[model samples]
Target: MGALLVVILALVVGGCVCVVWADRGGPRWTRVVAAATVGSGRVLRRYQKSQRREVGGGADGDGD
Candidate 1:
């Protein structure tokens, strides 16, 4: 499990690098990878924001 997490982390970092490289007009494959990386990041951000709303959306009035 630990090894799997490490590998995933490495891939995310590499994808980020590819995003930067592709911004300056890199090769076709790097451009493809960068687009994928950006799309994945958007999905991940949406998931995280939804989780936060679920946790903190309580309507109870406690403060005075």
Candidate 2:
């Protein structure tokens, strides 16, 4: 389980690096990887925000 987790993390990090490289004018294949990476990041961000809302009752209540 631990090894699997490490591999998954490595892949995610690698994808993110490729995305950055593509943004800097990397090869065509990198551009494809970059698009997928960005899309996945957006999805993950949305999911995380929803999870936080559920756990926090949709408000921080700190008056700000």
Candidate 3:
């Protein structure tokens, strides 16, 4: 019975530690992060579009 009580106490303490850690923002920092993520995604899209060739444009020097 003593060993069982020790095990239960350990489990309860471990759970409390986990709760505190999570309340401290376990790993996600999205809330405090800047809006640069959205801005950069737009910039990347524009860059990709600029690299693409137009439908009427051809690689050859002649239009015949």
Candidate 4:
């Protein structure tokens, strides 16, 4: 009975963890605001890469 209880507890905890994790994809405007903000370096890099592909030069090539 105790072993069963332990298993149930573990399963409950695991489910809670999964729920929390599944809820953590960030806000709807996260990507849009990230491309604007320096908080998301990876998104910024991808945006810059796309911009470079669209244009002829790297993002840094333009004068700041």
What TM-score, over all chains together, does every model reach? 0.80, 0.79, 0.40, 0.38
Give the Cα RMSD of candidate 2: 2.5
How do all the candidates rank in terms of lDDT, highest first? Answer: 2, 1, 4, 3
> What ranking of all candidate models by TM-score puts the best one first?
1, 2, 3, 4
Best by lDDT: 2
RMSD over all Cα atoms, model 4: 15.1
Q: lDDT of all predictions, in order shown?
A: 0.88, 0.89, 0.55, 0.59
Of 3 and 4, the candidate ahead on lDDT is: 4
List residue ranges in candidate 2 displaced over 4 A: 61-64
Instruction: Compute the lDDT of residue 45 as modeled in candidate 2.
Output: 85
Tens-digit lDDT track of model 2 for 1-64: 9999999999899899999899999999999998998999899988987787889976866452
- How many Å off is the CA of 54 in candidate 2? 1.7
**Deviation in angstroms for 43 in model 2?**
0.5
Report the lDDT tens digits of candidate 3 across residue range 1-64: 9999999788556555555555677645432232334455578776765554354354535433
* Candidate 1, pairs of clashing residues: none
Worst 10 residues of 1 by lDDT: 55-64
